[model samples]
Target: MGSPRAASSRSRAITEVCEAKLRMMGGSLRELESGKAAALEEEILRTDAKLEELGQLADAAARDLREDFEQAMELLQSTRRVKEHMLVDHRQQLGDVAERIAALRSVRDEGVKACEAADHAEMVSFLSKHASTYSQECWQLLARPLPRSIQVPLDDIPFEVAKRRDLLRGAQCSEKLARMKNEVLCDIVDALRQERSTHADTREYAVEVESLLEAYATEWEKRFDYACSYCGQVLEAALANEPYCGAMPGRKAHHWVPTDTAGIAEAKETARPQLPVAAASPRLKSQAKIRAISPMFRADSSV
Candidate 1:
């Protein structure tokens, strides 16, 4: 065996070597922990900054969306008011035209009956007395200044010799004018009805769009709230790949699931609004349908 002093010296050298190695390892471990802490702090600051930026962006987006929604609402309201006024005007005009058409038909029918019952002399006298008045009335239906070329004499001729020719001409002019006015009034009625129907369709579509916009605005307003409820701040943080409510560490994201709200259920069940269209008149079907003022002045010689 070696001397005891030599053995003790060897044991001391081994102990010193082990102590040096342990110190080196402890220094390396401290550096690693410090580096990790600094990196974690930097990540936290960066994430907070990102969150602030996202909030600002969301606010700006919400503001723009609200402005657009308000503008759309204003436009819809104004359009609705204008359409209501137009509908009222159309109804009034239609009623006036209907009454006028009925009066014209009644008077024309009476005149036809009178002409059918009259002898030649009575017929001639009747035509002479009423032809100018009837002609003027038909010309007035134009609702504007008449052309100078198509003149209707304001008064009947007093001369007995010229009565037959002038009276016949006046009656013919009255019949032609009446037919033209009738056609015009019928066209107006048809156009008015068609416009009303078109307005109804347009209103229906507008209502549908209005509903959709309202729903969109509602959802947009609640988007942040929904996000908060769904994932809490964990989703906002860069912690988990999937949504989490409370904590991100060691917690699974499989507990909560989205369910349809009452509003969504009601929307699905709701029926779309549809406006009724005006029905077309059978009498005012076509312009070519001849409504003669009298059988005597019938151009096609058909009653």
Candidate 2:
């Protein structure tokens, strides 16, 4: 009985010891789990902080990009407005040139008509003297209204009809005269054409010059509301008022003369009064007085 009781006690003690060991191991495992959980929480907090910082940086970058974009947009808008204004001005200049061309064309047409009439008159005068010499058929052919095709043989035509001695001479003279008249007419036409061409070229050049001036004027106007017509002087409204008389005050005042007010006053003070014209003497005014004086003066004369 005693041996059985000892064995039972020992087994019970062993069982208790095994249970305590298991409990200690379980407690240690629990502590390790808690430590791992704490580490995981800290890692999560770090990740959250990193994400917040990234978000802040991204927001700042976005803000900067937006500001740059806005500035670029504003610059583009300003450039576009300037271009549009220039286009409008150019259109107006072109219209003015067109009107000038139209006027020039009218003048050119009148000149052409005048040249043609002069040529016709010369031809009629030349043909009138030789009217009776040619045959009826030849006269009729000459009279026929033809399109600028009258050709006189300069080197091979008769000079006279009755004797027919030098028939080619008259024809050659007529041809030479006709050629001279044609040359004069052509010169007139060419001169008129050249004048018109020169006028048009001048107009185009002026328009170009005006366009460049207008561009400069626009730029200047944007910077300065009022400017000198002769010089390019830029000033703000406030600064412009500082010296209201001159466009650029620090430099020499153009078109302005310094007047000496003190000298003018002194000159005015020194000026003398103008004298009146002397009247005739009262004794010589009357004829009786003049006769009396003459008699006294003639006492020593014999008469």
Candidate 3:
């Protein structure tokens, strides 16, 4: 209802009042909003930095674990190879030891068997010879063939009967007996022994016994080869050409010098000083000198 100019003046006054209120509150609100935004931005930057550091630490730990795993795997492989090589070597060594032991046992068994067989055969042959050769059958034949130990006593018995029986026994007839002697059986045994010595088998047996003794001596010599031949001292087996330190009667001296060569004894003898022959007594020498010089000194000393 008022004029146009009056309305305009009232609007201007209202606009000025609103503008003053806006100017008074806008700066404080803007400052509060700007502070809150800056604080949030700073907190976000700090959190991001912490996250980045934690991620870096995690990456470093992962790399360390991966390297350790790789190293562990390589070590396991090397140890496995070493274990395999050791197993093979040990197995081969065990086999060699077993083979050596078996060979030694075989040698021992064969030696024992051979010795037993030889003894048994010899004993059987001995008993067979005694049974067949010296029994009742051969006893009469041995009696009749009086080689040198004549024990028949043909002069004591009736000559005709003795002669007939002797003729029958001598012609290889041993069906019966002719008892006509005293203590003649012992003499017959002696004669039989004499006859046995002439046999070829007994000579062969003697030779065999000699050979057996030689074999035994050879075996013992081989067994004691490491021992000193003169002193019976045990020696080291490791030395291939061990020198003897033993004494000998021919050398006539105990030796520390090894007897590896023949020249040691000759050298000692060459270096030794020869002793002079002993002289006669002083009294005997003076008496001889006086007799050579003259009888005057002897006569004066006597007076």
Candidate 4:
């Protein structure tokens, strides 16, 4: 009975030891699982951080690309506008030149006709006889040698009357030629003045458009940090002193200047006077004088 009881106690002790070992093994397994969970959590956090960093980098890259693309587009648009203005200006110049050429041809034709009329033999012979007679009279008055004058009645003069008629015709033709020449000269001058004015207007408009485009580009560039993507330099430094560039200096906010359009219009209205219809030439001359003096008074009063 004592041996059996000792054997039973030994078996119980072995069971207790086995149970303790199992508990220890279970605790170690729990510790390993906890460590694995912590490691996985840390890995997840690291992956999230890496992804956030990548996202930030991607956003920055996208912003830079967008900025660059916008700048390129603005430059292209500016170039296109300038080209269009130039093409229009060139076309206008060509048209003006063609019109001037036509005007010159017309003037040349008029001159050729006048010259042909002046070269008529009958007219020339009549003018020559009058010239001889006038020269003789002039020489006699100046106490110089005079040719012998044929004394004949006016109606009985055969070639003398014809000579006088030819002289009158030559004088009339000369006056007509002079008037035509003056008209041609005036037309040419007017055409030149118009061409010059048009050219000036075109240049002014082109400059204004270019300035507007540059101002827009400048404002857009300032929003993108004004940095050159290619050279990594500050774009402001590159464009500080440049008159025209893809990126320009930003304009400071300014107060709007007041316009005097209404005042000018009012002043013009007040100064402008109604004129009476000129029935006589004297009244017309008086009106002209009044008009000329009115401008001076208007200028002084406005000032």
Cα displacement (Å) at residue 55, model 4: 0.5
lDDT of 3 by residue, 1-303 (tens): 999999999999999999998987898789887989789889999999999999999999999988966776676676667666766676676676566556555655655665677877755555565445444534454455322322332233234445657887775443333332334776888888989876755565555445444553553333323445566454544533545343565543222223333333332444321222224322223333323544422323311
lDDT of 2 by residue, 1-303 (tens): 579989999999999999999999999999998989889899999999999999999999999989967876676676667666766676676666566556555555655665678877655554563334435534454465433322333342222233233657778898999999999999999999999999987776555545444553453334223434434454346544443335445664333221344433343453311222224322222333333544422324321
In what order do the candidates fall by lDDT, top score first? 4, 1, 2, 3
Q: Which window of 10 residues has the lowest lDDT sum in candidate 3?
A: 272-281
TM-score of each: 0.24, 0.24, 0.21, 0.23
- Write candidate 1's Cα lDDT for 104-201 as tens digits: 66767766777788767766766776667776766666564422332334253234336557989999999999999999999999999999999987
The better candidate by lDDT, 3 or 4, is 4
C-alpha lDDT of all candidate models, in order: 0.59, 0.57, 0.55, 0.60
* Residue 108, model 2, lDDT: 51
lDDT of 4 by residue, 1-303 (tens): 579989999999999999999999999999988979889899999999999999999999999989967876676676667666766676676676566556555655654565678867645565554545655544544573233433333342234346668999999999999999999999999999999999987776555545444553453233234334333345456454644333334533222221344544554565543333424332234444444644543533543
Question: How much is 241 displaced in model 4, in angstroms?
Answer: 93
How displaced is residue 34 in candidate 1, in Å? Answer: 0.3
Pairs with backbone N, CA or C atoms under 3 Å apart (clashes), candidate 1: none
